[model samples]
Structure formats: structure tokens, C-alpha cells
Target: MFYDSYLYLVDGSYLPTVAPTGLKTDLGCWKYHFGAIEGMRQNGWTLWTVILIRLVAEEFNFKLSIMGQGDNQMLLIEFTETLPEEVTVNQVNQFISALEEKLSYIGPPLKIEETWISKDYLLYGKFPIKNRVALTTSWKKNCRMFRCCNEDFPTIETSLSSLAANLYAAVASDNVTQPIFFLSISDGHNQQFSLFLVIYQ
Candidate 1:
């Protein structure tokens, strides 16, 4: 089963963090995931974990993290675990409190904006467009835009770095005169959404 959760910044200016769930593992097995976690920690980024619980006939628990400084940063971490059927609100609050306390030593205090417990979601992908005229002319003609699953997206750090590099390259080249921004479109059923990063002249 593939479990996923998205954390959107309330401001809507930055790309939301997408976390695909991973199997729960023990601390002794940290070597498997520690490299990525440690690299972010060493770079002075704060990590905040968000837990999403879905309750139906059975309870499904998904964990993901947000990393940043002050209020403008995000990252992804994934963990999957099952909660006891009889868990109570008090127990859940206690767990969250403990998690926040544990993470305080490493960086800023963990702030959880919200918890999403929904069964319906839209699978997201990315499609890049290089021509502005093609979008205005005909959607049918531009059907060949490159598309890939969300899991295939570069890490937030990598995406930002790449965007910065591209901006610098565009500035240095006299031939490049287009601006880039993302356009997200959802299907009528809202079951799937695609993000188009358009670079137009």
C-alpha cells in the first residue's frame, strides 16, 4: 500500500512538501535512513514531523517531516506505523508533546500547523513547458509536456538549487528572456493533479 501526505504552507507562495510513507524501522537500523536526516541536520535546518492518522475499519498512521528556518523552509521524511485501535485523544496529545520536546534540542521548536485525516487525495505529477505561445494557442498541441510522478521529484533542496542555477544562467545569456513559474491543474474528478513549470519568452 502506498501512503502519502502533503504539507502546504498556508501562504501558498512555495511548493508544498510531499511525503510518501516508508516502513517503520528501529533506531538500530538508522544506517538505512540516517544519511539523509543527518545531512539536513548538519546543514542547520530544523526538522518537524507531522503525523496524519486515517481511521476507518482500521487505523493507518503516516509520518513525514518539514524542515526549514523561521517560517520559510520545508523538507520530506517518511515513516509508516500502526496505532492501537483503542488509542485516546489524551494519548495522542502526549505523544505529540514528547516528540516536540525531543526535537527541540536539535533546532527550533516543532510547529504542527494541522493534521489531515482524509481518505481521498489527488496524486500529483510535474510537467514542464518551455514555450508560452503553445499554452495560449492550443492545449492539444502541447500534450507532449514531460510528466513524472511526485516520488520522482527532486528533493526541495535540489529543486531550489536547480532553480537558482537556472536563473543565474538565464541572466548571463542574452538569448534567454522568459520568466518561470508553476501552474497546477487538477482533473475534473480531482483524483489526479499535474504541476506545470512554464518558462516563457
Candidate 2:
């Protein structure tokens, strides 16, 4: 239930928390952490599997991981370690294969990666949908339905959670009395993600 929103694996070598349990708990104990990390060389299969469903369950709670990226802003997650040879370590691989299998005619694999996400990237807070934006159980991260900019927010510095909270409060005043969004940022890692409800007037 807690493993939704945007999921990522902090390259263990660089992340402050070698285990990456998050601020709420230690990594060894958190189910989400355990699901994603498998000793550094690979992770994020199950974490990715759980993202959408978790977002749909209640309010949106975002998850993030910090990894070192070069000036190109690209992150290379070596899928080399847990190659999808066996179903045991192939959870994410299976998830991707199933989805791709279904949409085989759609012209791609079921799994899609963000070309590069930057510190300055404003995820769920970038636009006031519709001028008509709608969440409608859509992941909507890279969808043209919401506005994403080519610009990047400065990774070295930010206050995204506060900003997201303010935006949510501003949007949901009447109907959704208790909508909540939880955002956790690595004080050191510089990546931010938000989970927000689209208030329908």
C-alpha cells in the first residue's frame, strides 16, 4: 500500500542511507525498500510494479531514489545483475513483459523509462490540468495531458514538498476535505517527485 507514486532505487554506493529505508523507517524493515533493492547492482522491478496501484488506492504518496548521474542527466540502472533469466528475480521483468505482450502491436515494450529526470523537474505540480487536466487513474507522468517542461529545477537546492503541499491546499478546498500527498526527498540526492489529486470543480 505504501509503495506507490514514483519509485526509484538509490545507487547504494552514493546514497547516504546505504540501505535506503526512507525517513519513515530503516530499509531492511520497509517492504518497499526490500522489494526494490537487491544489493546495489539491480533494483526497482517490484517497486515499479507497485507504483500505479498504490497511487490509485487512496491519496498519492510519492517515492524517490537518489543516484549519481553525469552531466547528461541520464541514469544507467544496470539490469545486468538480475537479468530476467529466472522468474524469482524477474518480477519487474515479468511485469514489463506482460504489459508489452498485451500491447505488442502498440510498438514497444510495456516498460517505459524517463529519458532523464532532473532535480528541477516539477513532477505532479507542474500544471493546473485542463487548464482541464484529469488524473482518472492515469500515471500521467509523461503524458501530454499534463504539462512537463524542458527546463530543470536546480537539483542542488529545492523545497518541493512544501511547494506541493501549498499547491494541493490551494486546489482542494471544498470537495476533497482530507486529500494528502507525502513527498520524501533525499536531503543529499536532489531528485523530487509528488503525488497529488486533481481537484475537479
Q: Which candidate's lDDT is highest?
A: 1
Q: What TM-scores do the predictions have? A: 0.21, 0.16
Winning model by TM-score? 1
User: Taking the tens digit of each residue's C-alpha lDDT, what string does model 1 give over 6-101?
Assistant: 223355454433336532333221222322323434333422322211111023243443433333333232333364534533444555565556
For residues 46-92, could you state the per-residue lDDT of candidate 2 as single tens digits? Answer: 34433432333222122323232221112212234444535333543
Task: Give the per-residue Cα lDDT of candidate 1 at 124.
Answer: 18
* Inter-residue clash pairs, candidate 1: none
Task: Report the C-alpha displacement of residue 5, candidate 2, in angstroms.
Answer: 40
Those runs of model 2 whose alpha carbons end farther than 4 Å from true positions after fitting are: 1-88, 106-111, 114-201
Off by over 4 Å in 1: 1-43, 46-84, 88-92, 114-201
- Give residue 45's lDDT in candidate 1 (0 to 100): 40
